[model samples]
Target: MFTLFYVLSLAIACSAVSVDVSDATNRIANGAVAANLQFPYAVSIQRIANNTQVSTRGHRCGGALVTLQHVLTAASCMFEWNADGTRTPITIGNYRVFAGAYLLSNDTATERVRNIAQYVVHPNYLGIPSYVGDLAVVTLSTAFASSTATPLSLPANNYNPADFTDCVVAGWGAATAASQTGANVEQKYANKYIYNQQECTSVYNALQGLPNILPTMVCAVSYDIVSSSCHGDEGNALVCGNTLTGILALHSNCAATSYPEIYTRVSNYTDWVRPIVSLANSFTSGASVLLLLTLIQMTFANLLS
Candidate 1:
């Protein structure tokens, strides 16, 4: 069983990517409060403890709205490994997603909260130290109202990472690298530049001696040291222009001079996402009909057997 404590400890230790590192530059750490509705697709994911419906303090991560009833996030956000190396999946009842929420501490009429009905983690995702395909789709119990939250557009099938030189990342993640606190309730954003894969790999390899940066990942470096996502920013959206191009995956050192933040390339997995989102939308629009049809099919198959 993966307890809340275990996940929290891992979050604190990893700081949303890897173990926290000490850095002295404050200029390189400047994330500013996002403008209201600046990121309409942004959503805050709260992990409940003991199957409770209420949001547990300090159990939150960031995610992006992909469809009315679907969200895109990191697979690690929804699953963890047990003490015996067995995988423990988080229950749908343990999650609540808040859309159009700028400050979680304050209640706003504009905010739309929904319980998770189900989730699908990428089949290729393994675990830490090898976060290859760290992606997941979360299906909400109810669809978000269009007035409350608008889904962000996914990248084109032939979207080139090179064309996205100016990218913006938004989340309710920590404000600074040294702060061991949970994510800030206020939304924050920073501008970053996409880095060449080779250049990104060189920096990580030299700093951590781990060449884990894969082609499936997208890399970006902050224009300034203070403009990067730190711990609690995992699963946040990396938007280029109006499209979601990446999902926060890992980082070597938050706001460090040489290290760059890595994200799961959203473009690489569009093939996988399209089918899931289609099914989710269909299920949402015709729940009773689909359920009846599924039951009838199962009955017929059973009789034939």
Candidate 2:
């Protein structure tokens, strides 16, 4: 029930980790054209086929460059939705990431094209109700240049997202919720108001008729505008300053109306993520490491997302 700006008064007492408070004004509340260098950490995650990137078609999902050699994104983006409402897991080798591009329509020299050498889905992402622990990290075939594609930092410690006032999400999701083909060719950025844990749960239940909003997640909404996460941008970055804090998890509304956009809180899983990315150092000797990830048990759960 507290306004996000009340954050100023609370900051004096709370031991919460802080980020840039002025970011909200600099980033728009609704969708707007992103300058070429505005968000250098954002990358277009595309599907590759026949060893060629499907770039002419818009990106498959948006992802954040969490490390010079790894990307932080939703685990669900690793699938291809079938007509029968089932998702087929795509091969990790078929994934390609293009960084430092403003528009997908134009081929820019700034693009750092790298194929995914490997990806590790979170051990808890079992496709049950489907949103639990929906996170993944992909190692790039080669590290990107530090100047062109900057990696956003994970919180130095257990960070409270509510401590910061401005949080922005930028992606190439659809302009309108219902338009499948009218997807964003140009990357767009928007400001979203973060809600407290209680309001996040209540607002989701009231607005989307959603039965559950887990503790592992955070919710935000563009209250003054119709902006919300839509089709094609499930793994976009939700950033507050240089910190990459959320990954777009569910954009359940597809009717040109806004609902509480769900994001997987990065702070909650920082411990699990850091090790996965740091392990990339093994690739230094030019030797392939077989990643033995713990398989999530899905035997008793519904597989449809």
Candidate 3:
């Protein structure tokens, strides 16, 4: 089982404000501060030093809460590539998840912090240059209280990507490509339009010399060049009408003038995800059984004494 920890005195003072969803959708460039409770399913995957206090630093990636105890993200976020082009899984000790976090600088009392119990990456995923099957499920040590946050639903098997044009991507990643120094303290979000896969493939192949966009990937472009997901946004969610549609994969260049961003098509892998989620629940069930057995053993010992 994983252990939970807390970071104290990090909350900042900020007034909650309201935003019009339509206006937000039409806006262009650099994204905007997300409204409080705007994205209850968004989560921050943070990396902390061993034996150190939790700080605002070390945010590794972003993800979406897909179940009470599971977060969906890119498999690349959980592994490191070596000089020899081989990959190694990252240790669980270096990470934690913060759910219902609107502002990292101002973590509210309701936000939930959880340690990762275990994670499963797609079997076909290899490192860079070929990010096919780039998805993973992060199981939390403990489930989040229902009152604290609700999990986002995955797209149905019959769901068609072309039917949804307006979409939103949210994360604590760099707000702009020009400023990649630090991630936003508060969650930032922007609107993007799903683009034709052929057009997206043409752009990437011509510019970056990369392979054609795979069937397992989806492409989206910002209304303009200035607003797009950048560094630190990896593994974030591409949500359409509250349904998780994709996982952030790659972009030609952060806020590029021509290239569109690529995401792992979640709709294409519902079969792979559903079973892993069921497996995650078994971990919780096993933990409960162990606890009960320990309690009963203690009770019998006391009776003999």
Name the best candidate (by TM-score). 1
TM-scores, all models, native as reference: 0.79, 0.76, 0.78
Candidate 3 lDDT score relative to the true structure:
0.69
Scored against the true structure, residue 113 in model 2 reaches a CA lDDT of 78
Q: Rank the models by TM-score, top first.
A: 1, 3, 2
Instruction: Give a tens-digit lDDT track for model 3, residues 1-305.
Output: 01111001001100110111101111113777788768888887877546552432456788899997999998888875465556678788777788765766544343478889889999988657667898999999899888777888878866656833888988776544344233336778878778788766655554332445887889886765567665667788988767788998774234334346789999988889998898667647566868878999999999999
TM-score of 3: 0.78
Clash count of each predicted structure: 6, 0, 0
Give candidate 1 regions above 4 Å deviation.
Answer: 1-29, 49-59, 80-87, 107-111, 177-184, 205-211, 252-255, 285-305
Q: After superposition, how far is residue 287 of candidate 3 from its true place, in Å?
A: 3.1
Ranking by lDDT: 1, 3, 2
- Per-residue accuracy of model 2 over 1-305 as CA lDDT, tens digit each: 34343332222322211111101111122477888868888877765445353333436777898888888988877766554456677676775888876776543453467878878889888542347888888888888888768888887557766733578888776654324452236778878767667855655444322335787787766654456565666788888766777898876332223345678888989999898787776543244432222122343244543
Runs in model 3 deviating more than 4 A are 1-29, 51-56, 82-86, 107-111, 176-184, 207-209, 256-258, 285-305
Displacement of the residue 305 alpha carbon in candidate 1, Å: 22
* Alpha-carbon local distance difference test for all models: 0.70, 0.65, 0.69
